[model samples]
Target: MRIGLLTEGGYPYARGEARLWCDRLVRGLGQHEFRLYALSRDREQERAGWVDLPAQVTQVRTAPLWTAEVDGTWYGRRARRRFAQHYGDLAAGLCAGPAGAPGQGGYSPAEADRFRSALYGLAELAREEGGMVAALRSEEAVRALERVCRAPGAPRAAREARVTDLLLVGAHLEQALRPLSLDWYEEGELGSVDLCHAAAGGLAALPGLLARHFHGVPLVVTEYGVPLRAHYLGSADAPPAVRALLAAFHGRLAAEVYRSAAVLTPGNTHVRRWQERCGADRSKVRTVYPGMSAARFAGAGERPGGRAGAAGAGAEPGTLVWVGRIEPSKDLVTLLHAFAAVRQRVPGARLCVAGSAPDPEGAAYLLHCEELAGRLFPGDPPVEFVEMGGPAAPGLADVYARGAVIVLSSVVEGFPVSVVEAMFSGRATVSTDVGAVVEVVGGTGLVVPPRDPRALAEACVALLGDPERRDRLGAAARARAMELFTVEQNVAAFHRIYLEVAGRCPARRIAEADAAAPRPFAVPAELRVAGAGSVEVTR
Candidate 1:
């Protein structure tokens, strides 16, 4: 089987979970060939270069989503008319109110069809012409957007859109729709792949949608975090009109992607619910947990009853561990206050905050946390901050081994990777009830409500005081992690899913003999299992 793996931002290039998981997926499924279709987030990511490719990776193609290049494809009179009509319909769809005032970002079937038709129509136009680069950013496009925004039945926020708002929305749409202009849909490229598995939804899945549109390829969309939810969370500061327009656009796009995909693989029930709310078919949705390696935590898991200080991993009997990226969303300040309460009860209790700051905002938040810790615990603060990879920073295994209990204080989280890691390391955990924290912990650890220092501190104190309970939870967590979240399980689930999707789709091969035909796969053949015999590449 040949797979066209689609991704955006962190993968192959950027050093993060995206890169790790994708690399693991390809390496684990060595029997299948992979073709990477990556969209880089910025120059920094592209400059970072790619990881070593395995022999099974037949090809790699990357494009930039951060910058737009003018392809100078001037449209003639007829082309200009086609562009205006399609662009008008698309903009109008964005401005239309949801059925029965279902509120912003809500799906209305009639308008969904309009948006879907206009999107593919624009894609078809881009294919006919060289690209939609200039036209998408043209004065005419802005005018079309403004015209739709002012139309009779447009949403109130959209109707209030100013000229500046139109330009901002238009510029964003141009970058997003740039995928439609890519030359990857040709017969010998994506058309030839047996399956197209998107590493994410939203922009990452756009190419796969085009492949399904142009050829008969099947698409599988996997989302660890729903992109629409991210957009809503991140766009809080944008102007009302701009926010409304973008939200509706993303919501409609997600709906169309869900409607078209052969399968939807969400990393947890949290993400699965988001997909369903946005119009995903429940029958087509599968929950596949992200895979992690237990080898690094093997020694830690084996010594669940061992004291961290005894092993020189840097923790006392009452030390609590917090591990993850340093950001405002992590709610570290609350963790500090919680620790203060824990210290009052346990007397010798301490907290160790260990993680890296991915951005400047996070760095500032880390400083605030440090100051808060100083104020709360005064001289010789028991709260320690350790940057990942620093000289004093503990190794991954040591990080868990050092703590009597692992703590997660995030007000917002998605598939809490650290919780799984802690579980693999055989450590009892205390995580806030956010995102997939409760789902991932699977009753193996204590969970508290977010923003409640009292609850968080109580949970930590309980675990610290009861060594037997901690050991039991730790052992159970390790068992659960091994059974459900290991690399072998993740890879096997996907392998089976791949075969199931392939079996359900029509069996055909894109024959080179009729390469010029509009429908590339004009030939048919019987579908065979991967090892049974030679199987033709058909989506």
Candidate 2:
């Protein structure tokens, strides 16, 4: 099978979960040929360089999401009219509320069809016109949007949008809808592949949507994190008008993707709920958990001279370890407060925070955490920050191995890799009851509510004190991870799904194949009947 794997700031990148999972799939499923279609998030991501490709990877195609559309500065009168007609319907659709979203009822099936027609019409216009940038940025585009926002059927929120909001929306729509102008659906591109598998939703899934639209190709959208939700979360920084317009645009796009995709694979039940809320058909949605490399932590996971699985490979007796990228969402402040409580309970307790701040905000958060540690225990701070994936433990297993209890204090999370890594290391976990933590832990470890320092402290203290119980839970955790979350299991699940999806669409594909002149002996002797139908085969 040929798979067109679509991604954004993921797969084939030097870093990130999407890259890792894609690499694993390409490598593990050697029977299938993979063509990576990746979208670089920014200049830095493009400059970071791609990971080494596996033997099964046939080709890699990349486009820059951060780059401006290469617009040819001209549009004739007919072209202007075409753009207006298509853009008007698109603008009107964006002004309406998506089904199940808060607004004037929901976009009815008729409205949905109208939206789809408008979206595809614009896509066709973009292809015919060479690009969308010129028309999308035209003054008429803003006027069209303004008219739609104030229309009778427009959402109250959209109608409240000012001129600045209309301009912002028009600009954003130009960028986000740039996929409609791409030639990825042309011959020998994504259309040639047997399956179009989107590694994420939103922009990453756009190409897949187009491939399915143009070629009748089956699309499998795999979302480990809901990009629409991410957009909504980050939009809080924008003004109300800007936020409302972007929200409506993204919501409408998500519904279109969900409605058209052959299958939607949400990495966890946590993400699955988001997809469901975005109007994904429940029957077409599958919960396929993200796969992690258990081999990375196999050394620490080995049960040695123990009654049960202990964090035996250089495990410290009373230390709590938190491993991940240092970010505000991780709620390290709560972790610090919890550790302060742990210190009072266990006099000799210690903490080793192993992770890096991935961004400027996170770097600041890391420094703030250090300062908080100083204030919490000025005289002799037991909380030490160690650089994880160090030369001594390059695999990151040493970070998990060094702890009696693996702690996670994230208030916002999505199928946390740190918890799974700890489980693979046979280390008991104490994580906040957020996102997929409870689902991943599966009764193998303790889960406390987010922002509750006392609950976090109790969970961590329980694991640190009761070595026997920790050992049992650690064993159970490792077992569960192996059974459900290993790379092998993930690949196998997707492999089956790909076959299932493609199997259902074979007739359509076959119908599209060229029925050229038939060879004289095309029919076998045994199979050839004397009067099998009219017998006027194509010549």
Best by lDDT: 1
lDDT of each: 0.86, 0.82
Quote the lDDT for 352 in model 1. Answer: 87
Write one digit per residue (lDDT tens) for candidate 2, span 1-539.
Answer: 67899988888989654888888888998877788888887888878898999888878888777776556647799988988998898777776665554222246676667778888888877777777877888899999988988889777778788898788888888888878877788757877777899998888888888888888788999998889989999999887878988887787788888888899999899998887777788899888999888877877887555323565446887889999989899999999999999999998999999897767998899999999999999987899987654465444876788889899999899888999999988989999998899999999999999999999999888888888888889888888988989998999889778767755665233222444642221111112223848353221
lDDT of 1 by residue, 451-505 (tens): 9999999999888888878878887888888999998998988887887887788
In model 2, residue pairs whose N, Cα or C atoms come closer than 3 Å (at least 3 residues apart or on different chains), thus clashing, are: none
Return the TM-score for candidate 2, rounded to 2 decimals.
Answer: 0.91
TM-score of each: 0.93, 0.91
Collision count of model 1: 0
User: Least accurate stretch of 10 residues (summed lDDT) in model 1?
Assistant: 306-315
RMSD of 2: 6.1
